[model samples]
Target: MKRFAIGDIHGGLKALKQVLERAKVTTQDQLIFLGDYVDGWSDSAAVISFLIELSKTHNCIFIRGNHDDLVHHWLKTDEQNENWLKHGGQSSKDAYAKLTLSEVEEHKKFFSNLENYYIDPENNLFVHAGFANMHGPQNEYEPYMVYWDRTLWETALALDENLKPEDLLYPKRFKLFHEIFIGHTPVTRINQTKPVNAANIWNVDTGAAFKGPLTMLNIDTKEIIQSEPVHQLYPNESGRN
Candidate 1:
């Protein structure tokens, strides 16, 4: 069976559907979603519903994103930080307004049960974001680290251009995984519209929360599939600025 790693969806349900169809994902395939399934677009609730249905038929692994954490907190306490609202959390709140109480509960359960990170048998690590102060894959790290750490990617990018993979001294987290996949920080931040590979880390967050497209990478073959630009999918509104 093939393994596919999808980047942050950010409520772009249309883009998500397109990428999955383009990849021709089957029941036997393992689908790993890096995180940020909600917020940004107008269909956060719908996206969660789709994921719930998808999980019933496919081997799906969902990693909790910072946005997901924020939503969970809001669901439990009805409190949201200003930054969360500014960065598309308002849209998520609006999306959930349409769901029934039971549906909302189901969505809550789905988000609450999300994994912070996942490690495959091949030692590939999948997380919403990189870890900080990591000793190994098994070592416990802060939850925020899984959703906010950018130092790992930054260090890899700062390496000398002439340094070869074999000659590199990887950080503890990198050494623990054959390859690491992450999605919290969009690759667009570096002015790229596609997945960016730095050292052994592959970042697939193609900025679907704004102007870029959704991306899905076939982990085993390194085949990349992307949807049409996300803005086009939701012409009626500006998706989270």
Candidate 2:
């Protein structure tokens, strides 16, 4: 069975559906989603509903995202974070407003149950963002770093490419996993609209929340499937712009 690392969907259910169909995903395939499944487009609640149902029939691993955490808090306490509201939270609120109390509770459970990070049998690490500890995510003193840190990606990107794993200058974190897959930071920041590899860390977030398309990468083969730019799919709305 194939294992795929999917990028941040950011409420782009249309884009999500497009990539999955383009990839021709089968029930046997393992789908490791890197999170940020809500808070950008008009289908935040719908996306969660779809994912909840999809997990029942497919091999799916859902990693937690900072946005997911914020939404869950709002659902549980009715408190809205101003920063979150400024950044795509308003859209999420708008979408979730349509759900019944029971449906909302179901979504809260889904959000609460998301994994902070996932380590596969093959030693591949899947996280929504990055971790800070040198010993790896499992040893992080700050658990939230696994889903909110950008230093891991920054460190990976800043490392000298010529340095081999066996070299003394190599990072201990990189040696802890066969490969690391992350989302959080969109590759669009670097002007690339695709999954990017820095050392052994693969950034799968292609900025579907903004102008880029949603992406899915085949972990073993390094093949990719992407949807159209999300804004095109939702022309009437600005997606976290």
Candidate 3:
């Protein structure tokens, strides 16, 4: 089966659909989202709903990004703070504002079910930010560590469950894996046209919210398929504002 790891959606539902269509991802393919499903665009609620459905049909692994973390907090606390509002959580809240109590609960359930990180059988891992190794010799951390730090990555991978560096970042016992996939740091952004690509890590956030493109990688082939942004039409003004 072909597995795919996608970058942050950030409320870009249209882009997500277009990319999925272009990739021809069926029920057969395994889809892993790298987090930040809400924030940049205008469809946070829509995107979440789509993801819940997708998860049922395909092997979907949803890793929580920093932005998603905020959303979860907002849902539980019901406090509409600035941090939550500016980072796509507000869009999600607005989307659900009109729903019935039952419907709202359903949405809460979906958000509650999301995972923080995932480790594939191949020893490959997917995370939002990155992991921090806490106790082991390697002090192996989680995926959240990756989103924010690169230097400590070596140290985190140094330890395992027992808190000891197994002598291998990824234990040789698990077999060799090619790469670790992540998102959060954009490769390119609307503000900065120049991209910061991660050579060792695959940064898939192609800056869709900045109107770049929705990118997905075919893990087996390392091929990136993307959907160009759908431009919004504006009214032509002969003299009107």
Task: Give the number of the best model, judged by lDDT.
Answer: 2
lDDT agreement with native, every candidate: 0.89, 0.94, 0.64
Q: Tell me how far the alpha carbon of residue 48 in candidate 1 is from the true structure, in angstroms, after superposition.
A: 0.4
The global Cα lDDT (0 to 1) of model 1 is 0.89
Once superposed on the true structure, which residue ranges of model 2 sit more than 4 Å away at CA? Answer: none
* Number of backbone clashes in candidate 2: 0
Q: After superposition, how far is residue 218 of candidate 3 from its true place, in Å?
A: 0.7
TM-score per prediction, in order, is: 0.95, 0.98, 0.76
Off by over 4 Å in 3: 134-177, 189-199, 230-241
> Among these predicted structures, which one has the highest TM-score?
2
Model 3, residue 157: distance off in Å is: 18
RMSD of 2: 0.8
Worst 10 residues of 3 by lDDT: 232-241
Task: Give a tens-digit lDDT track for model 1, residues 1-241.
Answer: 9899999998999999999999999999999999999889998889999999999999999998888889888987899789899999999999988989999899889988999899999989999888876675346455677787788888777876676556645455567688999998888888988999987899999999988999999998899999998999999979977
lDDT of 2 by residue, 128-239 (tens): 9988888888898988889899988999889998899999989888899999999999999999999999999999999999999999999999999999999999999998
Residue 127 of model 1, lDDT score: 90
By TM-score: ranked, best first: 2, 1, 3
Model 3 lDDT tens row, 1-241: 7899898777778778988999898888999998888655657777888888888788888877777767767777887777666555556777667667776677678777777667788767677665445332123444445445444333333335453324445443222234567677665533532223332345676676555667888877888888764223111211001
